[model samples]
Target: MSRKLSWGAAVALVAVTASVTVSLTYVYAMKSFNTKVADINERQAMYTKLSEIDQKTRQDYIGSVNEKELNDGICAGYAAGLGNSQAKYLSAEKYKAYLNGSSEKSIGVGIKTVQDKDGNMEVIEVTPGSPAEKSGIKKGDTIVSMDDKEIVRLTYGDALNKLDGAAGSKVKFGILRRQNAAGPSAEAKAALLSITVTRAEYAEQTLTSSMINGNVAYLKISAFTDSNAEQFNNMLAARIKQGASGIVIDLRSNSGGSIRGMAEMLDTLLPAGNTVSYRDKAGKTTVQYTSGPNTVNLPISVMINRNTFGVAEIFAADIKDYKKGLLVGERTAGLGTKDEVKPLSDGSAIILPVADYLTLNGDVFSGKGIGVDIEKELTSEQQALLVRNQLKGDQDPQLQAAVSALIRQGASVEKAPGTENAPVNSNAAATE
Candidate 1:
């Protein structure tokens, strides 16, 4: 009876141990399966998002954009060990300096460059007063190389960089010239010339005024530079106090700068409570209102041409709209949009158009350009004649016309070359 009880107890013990072992093994297997299933689901979700991005890019909606294009734009950059092996990429600041434009003063070699049909660079213009012009560098001269450097594959940027250095530097350029293609079968001839140029400091200002013939004030503005607004304010004050009756504001060759400068000047000219509204992206509108008293309420005539752009156009349009001044001579350069410069990771930058400008009447002042109140062009004889018969004077015919228009409006005049304090009536006398 004792042996039977011991055997039964051993059997029960084995059965309980096997059941617990089986339950633990089943639980471990179920947990492993769940972990793998979760990993697959997460990967699938990531791939789905990528697909959506791709699809949206292909659709040409304003809301949709190409991820690749945006990434490769000026905002993004190259990965490690990428780009041209032989070339050095510029930094962001360096690229910005290139776009900002620099004043280069070289002892006037006067070589004008143009791109050829085969993409070869050539000289198109040369000023007679310049050193290169004196050195027999003329039009139709093809530039082959410079300073022992081959320019066969060099880009326009690279070539320009090579041309720059400290003042008094000498650079030799290899050129080829073709006389004629229609009559002669002569091949282009090669010419090697060395031009030594001493660079000078060039100062550009937005506002410049000088009193001619005692009373008439002539103000020539090139651009709305940062320092120019203050200068303009002080100059205007002085001119107004000087008891001037007529003003000639020359905007010819003046590519406009800051819009703020335009508004500041407009404030001095326009009455209070009136506003100048400009348009931006998405048809959004921005307005700048006149907030101060008017300055120099005298007879005025503005000089304009194909080079008068941006804020210059806006100013001209404002003057016409308010009937403040006579818009004399030619049309304006129709670049009426605002742009923002975006820097890239690899140092390249892009200028993106951001806004469109408008008049006080909500008119778009672009594409068609600002129209002139008086239509005038230089005659063949007037165009042939150099300004004041001097080396440096106005080449723009519109400038001569502006002076004429001012005198026509019964403003005092200073005739160039013959007599002092002479009142001229005819256009010939005005031009002379």
Candidate 2:
């Protein structure tokens, strides 16, 4: 009787297990089918769009459009649209390397810093288990000197570049820590921290956006990575849906990403068609970024500074030339070199310039930055006020200027306190 009961229990358990396996198999199969369907739909849509673009090509032009030119146009247009006009067309290997996002090497003392008030280089964040962190480097500590150069004037990019060297190399640093408001106390001695960090590839997240003042949309792009164009398009659509009026594009410290990505962004904003032109290696001039319908009618104010560089320069120049919106703040950092990311056999990458970049009207912006129409230089007192607002963690000055300018141009600034109407005082707003 006991043997019979045990056999029955085993049979029941086996049946239950079989049922679960069948159910799970069905669920996974359905999920895979749905994913395949979605991929097909996306590919279909892409094919249709490309077909449309190609359908319009005149036979003469089509015959002459070599593989290189087509690829170059696509790259240039995408870069121009996204505001990084300095992007050079990348070959397959180079594009692969660009997509990898891996820095060729990493140095010890993994940390990052930004400028603070009183012109000090303050450590913003320290990587855990990094040489710097292990050697008593803390967040909020001031980095006085690295090797020899003062950190006060080095841009964040320049500072990082200085910190990077061949693996197994040691770099000296002098640091200061501000314990309290009494002023920064220097470290008792220059901490000669040493570490041999093996060079490893790392991925950096490149796209981020937010709504400012509950309505104004602000987009911050660090570099033109592979997914930047697609991400920006989706974000812009979202911002428009959220009732974004004025856009303050903060490209202040953007070191430029991809030219093709820039063009893609421009296509979303401006009417599509040949927005930027470039000369390829074959001494042939090509135009890309045929305009699309201008979608958002909102006033755009692009914020740039001495740190805004690379393809960002092309954006400021082209947009200003087209009289699309206002370029605000200071002159941009003129880094107009379009580099091809050449991946070597050893898995290292070299960014080489293939061709010169040009504006739609044939203006060259490489090494020459775009100047803003409204130059709002901050006085020392104004700089202090800005810094205070910044320390309080406000990225609002450029937005304020953008909104104010738009308001002056007959747009409603904002609803006055205890008033039903969004009050409009054009002259006062302009002066402000």
Candidate 3:
């Protein structure tokens, strides 16, 4: 190695050394890059494993699988895992039925039902002049069976579907009627009865208004539908023209419907201000304000109960917040949120709460319902009796209380002497 070299040999030696240096540098760079790539792949190993499992199941599963069902189940399960009861997934058929039920027109027996503690379908109301009413069905009738199908085994949706059918179709129901009387000695005696009702197309009457105590307007809103605002305005204007000095809005058992309709009604009552605001998860707020002049300056009272939910609760809460009225009856069902129904490509749909609702003053009543100014708590039996009385055209104690409260608040309405809390006979009461 120490021997003297010629000029050509020295040049060749230098070239070889340069080539070796370049190779060594390239190897070191590749090693560093591979370490980073390996770390990244390791960090994402779970995702890759999931993809592999999904692919295997699709191609190599032992049993037959419905891709639609599987995908729907995955979606429903994911929504359920969120742990929100307000969230739900509706099948194509169910979604269609829900939309039809919400519309102003429907084809069915025209009765609303609820599940009792024992899972029996209890008729909450029978629409007047409907087949259910014409067939002698009454409120509080427990449906034991429908067309030989046990109602106890059916879910709420199933029961509703069972009751609904095409126009001119007939359905039979086995009902258990309970004897109702207003006395301490009145015992519930159940009697079995069967009736056949024909389904028919009928217009839904969501609102009814009448003059009470000579100059007070009593409006009962079953639900806040799309046409409720216009109906309410017309009724109010007519009652005002007929010399009504106060208004009592009965929202008991009103499982809420349209929020926009509710806002429209509120705009007529509340002064120009923020009526409600929806707060998203990102802490962003979108508000709805009352525009135009508040024409109805008369005293107002709102009736509510545990069944009053959704937009109805918001209406009551806004009335109380603005000091525009007194809230009577029990506390409301606090379901203060807005649900958005998104339809999927496969005719399925998802309903989820998109935002939490708040009053104009920023009061959130999600779980804790809006408390009543005058709490009138009643037992289930008492409520049943109240409904029975109402069906018989008797004055509802809650409504009478509202009227008395309005009169006490200096409303120009006249209260009959000794008629406080007394039942109003059908012959003497004003027709709605």
Candidate 4:
């Protein structure tokens, strides 16, 4: 039996309960309000400081300031302050050129270069049949001068800028080439030769495929820019048709590109499943892509290095998650964060991180990059030789490791670890 409360006592209890509930609600509301107020005040203080500085500059600055440059500087500085290396602000003109550059098309003499240890711009790659090649610029040549402008240690970028101009325009260059092409490199004599190259608009070859080690196909993917899926498929199909027992994909310096392109490339091999997902700072995960079911399961080997970034990391991680391939070479660059290119009203743009990429297994390869099953490191000299196209056949240790792994895995590829393949729908993404 329960004891009944008197009406007056019950009324007193109800009043105390209501008072406590109201007090908690008030406290919570105040806490939220105070937080919002603090945030607003902090933002106001920042704006006030900026306004004060702007006023001072306008009043007493001796030099005439270009408003556009000043604004761009501020934007660039703000992005730099974020400490995200990939975050950047691009002016309208640069943004336009950047967009145009993504098609693997260029309006300059086709030669890719890197600043050598000697601080000289050394040619690493010369596009086939390009004006640079036709004009006698080889893979190992160094540009000494461009259009009478000396390409010294400094202002080298300015000198290379001269390579870009109206189509059909000719650019003169002084190239230093080794006289002894096949002799000992340290002792080889070099000569400076002057040549004229025409700047023409042409598509760049993003990938190269060849049959190596008799039954294996080797594909070097330099960058992930333009959608090269069709070409990639054609090359792989040809290799498969030619009895390629294993496939080795070299993404040593492949900074990722189109998410769709990566998906297409991976879809050619990955069975239908959750390939990758995106997780925000709030821990909300949205599936990025579900791979289609039609698959080309093969004894696959993915060769990566410290420079394999963005979607390339995703590609390799996906393969690893599916037990689809052996990742050979160094760990990936681990920069698998997604950035959004937000355009300003003035036609300029800013890129900033929007979220992080998550593998199908809920793995984050952001700052902590993807690891490989076979860890083979490349010496700095050998790495230089690699990007410079100086690595001869059977000389790349990482490639050798990949080839060996593929050969070993070829016989039991289907029996490799991981759950059974499942069918799924569309997905893909990437960066650089």
Listed in order, each prediction's TM-score against the native is 0.54, 0.55, 0.73, 0.84
Residue 383 of model 1, lDDT score? 35
The number of clashing residue pairs in each candidate reads 0, 33, 0, 4
Model 1 Cα lDDT, one tens digit per residue, 175-207: 666554454776655545544444322333235
Give the number of the best model, judged by TM-score. 4
Name the candidate, 1 or 3, with the larger TM-score value.
3
Writing each residue's lDDT as its tens digit, candidate 2 over 371-418 gives 887776555554443332231113334445655655554444343212
Lowest-scoring 10 consecutive residues by lDDT in candidate 3? Answer: 422-431
Residue-level lDDT tens digits of model 4 in 258-344? 777887788888999987688988989988777898988688999899999899999999999999989999988889898889988
Task: Tell me the RMSD of model 2 versus the true structure.
Answer: 24.1
Worst 10-residue lDDT window, candidate 4? 423-432
lDDT of 2: 0.61
Compared with the true structure, the alpha-carbon lDDT of candidate 3 equals 0.79
Off by over 4 Å in 3: 1-74, 114-119, 122-124, 129-142, 155-157, 165-170, 175-200, 387-397, 416-432
Q: Rate the local accuracy (lDDT) of all candidates.
A: 0.62, 0.61, 0.79, 0.79
Residue 272 local lDDT, model 3: 79
Which residue pairs come into collision in candidate 3?
Answer: none
